[model samples]
Target: MELLDLLLHPVRLRIVNAMFGGRIRTTTDLCRRLPDVPKTTVYRHVGLLADAGILEVADERRVHGAVERHYRLSRERARIDAEAAASMTLDDHRHGFAAAMAALLAEFNGYLDREGADPTADMVSYRQFPIWLDAQEQAEAVAALTPLLRGLAEKKPRPGRRQLLLSTILFPMGEVEEGE
Candidate 1:
């Protein structure tokens, strides 16, 4: 399946999100992380991700006669290539965007639901900025941000370090209405 098609499913998207931060997780770990999702559903989606090469087995061990596999995200295979992204139609983009937004909402809610949740202490930031930029400026902005984002992704999981989800959406704004 195409990367877009594979990831657009809400459960699949969440599964992928859970695999980030260079953490190796087993199927049991995923079940704990996504308590709302059924255990069978999580197993099925993890199998699909593994079959698609997006999730690879990092290790395995036998526990009480059952072998449990530890999986990690293959970052290269988890993303849509430039060619595939370029081929996406408006409708395709719409569906992909909607899926992404839904996943983000679910993750945010999960965070808020946790005990001792404190947005201020945790440094959660969710604000939109309206900026006017020409085509050249827009291109420059993306060029500048791309490397920064990649650098953050390159960091591996470590003790005392937390995994934070950062989602960004950049689009041209339509005509503005009168305001103060």
Candidate 2:
């Protein structure tokens, strides 16, 4: 399957997101974390991801006479490169974006459903900002954000640290109508 096709599915997308931060996770860990997803479904999709090289087996061990594998996202393969992005049709972009949004919504809903959840204490945030920028400014803005994002992504999990989802969508809204 195409990289985008494999990464864009709701289940697979969630799996990839779950494995972000370079953390290795076993099928059992995934099943427990994503209780809404059936165990069989998680196993099936995980196998497909591993077969496609999107996920790599980080470790394996024998558990109850069966081989249990721990996997981590292959960051390089998990992304849609510029070449692949350029080749995608408008329909593909639409479907992929919709699937991503749906996954984000599901995650947010799950967060809300958890007991003892405190959006304020947890630092949950959902906000939008309007900005005016020309092409050069836009490029500069992206350059500025890239390193900060990269640093955050590379930080290893530590004691007393919690994982936070960081979703960003940046696109031109459209040409300003007449004078707005």
Candidate 3:
């Protein structure tokens, strides 16, 4: 299956979200963190992602006298490649976006649970804006975002540091009202 297809599944999307922000985790760790998901399901998702080149076995060590693999997101920044992105049907994009949103929310909830449920944290930011951009202008937004992602993709991981940044951008289209 395509990388996009693998990521479109909720279980796999969660697997990616769970591994984002330089978060390298083993099967056991993922199972512990996402207790609502069955261990077998987690493994299945991980395998799917790995097969699609979206996740990689970043490290290996012994657990239970056997090798436990630690997986990491291969995507330094998430993006739909230009050709695939341009040709996507509306329904394809819709389902993909919904799956992505669900994964992100699950990760955010996990963070809240871990940080004593703090309302303020250095790692969190949220904002919304009503823009003046036209539909054509909005279509160009990904071009602006893609360059930064490409730069991020080049940075090598450092020792004792898993630098994972999960970024999500949503652009909603609706009827535009004439200015008064």
Candidate 4:
């Protein structure tokens, strides 16, 4: 499968997210964390990702006459490159976005289902900020935001650190008037 198709899949997306922050985990570990996903499905997708070079075996150990492999995301290979992304059609973009939203909803619902769930304490947020910007201004805005987001994504997981999902959407709201 194409890298975008593989990365955007619901189950595979969850698997990749589970391994974010340079985490190295085995299939068994992923199954435990993603209790909702079936073992067979996780194993299948992990194998696909490994074959695609998006995931690489970090280590292996003999277990029950089989090799249990630990995998981590190959950072460079895990993303849809610019050329590939540009090739995606509008329908593809819609499908990818929908899949991502569904995953986010699932994560949020899972959090709410847990005991002692506390959104405030966890700093959970879902808000919209409307901005009116011309093409040039919008480009500048994204340029400024990219580094901050990239820096956060590159941080290593540490003690007292919690995994947080960050999603952003930017689009034209309505037709711009002749002059702002």
Candidate 5:
């Protein structure tokens, strides 16, 4: 399957998110994290991701006569690159956006459901800022943020560090009307 088709499913998106930030997780770990999804379904989707090269086996071990595989996200394969994005139709963008929103909602709900959940304590912020930028400025802005985000992604887990989800969406709202 194409990368867009493979990554746009709600379950698969969640799986990808779960595997983000240099984390290596097993099928059991994924199943536990996504209890709403059936164990069989999680395993099946993980298989599909692995088959599609979006996931790789980081390690494997035998446990009670069963081989437990640890999977990690192949960031290169999980991306919707410029060429693929350029080829996506309007409906594809709509479906992709819907799937992404669904995944975000699920993750937010899961976080809220956890014990001792405190959005304020956790420094949770979901604010939207409207900025006016010309095409060149917009490109420059993205160029600036890309490396900072990548640096954060490259960081390994350490004590006293929390794994935080950062989602970014950038799109123009169109030019101002003449009257306005």
Candidate 6:
């Protein structure tokens, strides 16, 4: 099964994003963090992810009469291969992008909803531009950006350091010209 397809759901994506800080969380913790999601719905998606091998069962314990299981990302970062994505229809791309955008917007709304969301404590920004680049430069740009992402994916924060989310989206600015 394509984990990408499974993660396309906003709830699971949000849960995965919530776990990014080298932190593991149980169902209850997820419920608290994802107040907009019904607890049962969260559990159903979490179970699906675990079954898909995208989420690992990190820890477990009994909470009252029930067992609580904590979960963490099975892979440090999400990846999809060309072959996997090649078969998707235009509708799939449209729906997937819309889902991702909605998830992003929800996170921004979450920050705003945080207690004591001080301007000094938060900021968000984005940039876009039309540009020209040769194939080599385009490849180089992706190469240059990969390490920063790998660092975010692999770096385990120390006790004193706060966890941070480093999200980036990059692609060629249109088809590359042989000479530009």
Q: Which candidate has the highest TM-score of all? A: 2
Identify the candidate with maximal lDDT: 5
lDDT of each: 0.91, 0.89, 0.73, 0.88, 0.92, 0.74
Query: What's the lDDT for residue 120 in model 6?
Result: 54
The root-mean-square deviation over C-alpha atoms between each candidate and the true structure, in angstroms, is 2.4, 1.3, 3.7, 1.4, 1.5, 3.0
Question: Which digits, one per residue and each the tens of the lDDT, describe model 4 over residues 75-140?
Answer: 898888889889999998998988888878877787888889999998889999999887899999
What is residue 172's positional error in candidate 5, in angstroms? 2.0
Per-residue alpha-carbon lDDT of model 2 for 48-73, expressed as tens digits?
99999989998999999999998998
Alpha carbon deviation, residue 50, candidate 5 (Å):
0.7
Query: How many residue pairs clash per model?
Result: 0, 0, 3, 0, 0, 0
Least accurate 10 contiguous residues by lDDT in model 5: 171-180
Give Cα distance to truth, residue 97, candidate 2, Å: 0.7
Cα-lDDT of candidate 6: 0.74
Off by over 4 Å in 5: none
**Which ten residues in a row are the worst by lDDT in model 1?**
171-180
Q: Which ten residues in a row have the lowest lDDT in candidate 2?
A: 171-180
lDDT of 6 at 87: 75
TM-score of each: 0.94, 0.94, 0.72, 0.93, 0.93, 0.82
Q: What does candidate 6 score on TM?
A: 0.82
Error (Å) of candidate 5 at residue 53 is 1.3
| Tens digits of per-residue lDDT for model 6, 32-70 | 988877899988988888888777888888889888888
- Candidate 4 C-alpha error for residue 63, in Å: 2.7
lDDT per residue as tens, model 5, 64-112: 9999999999999998999999999999999999999998888888899
Candidate 6, residue 157: CA error in Å?
3.5
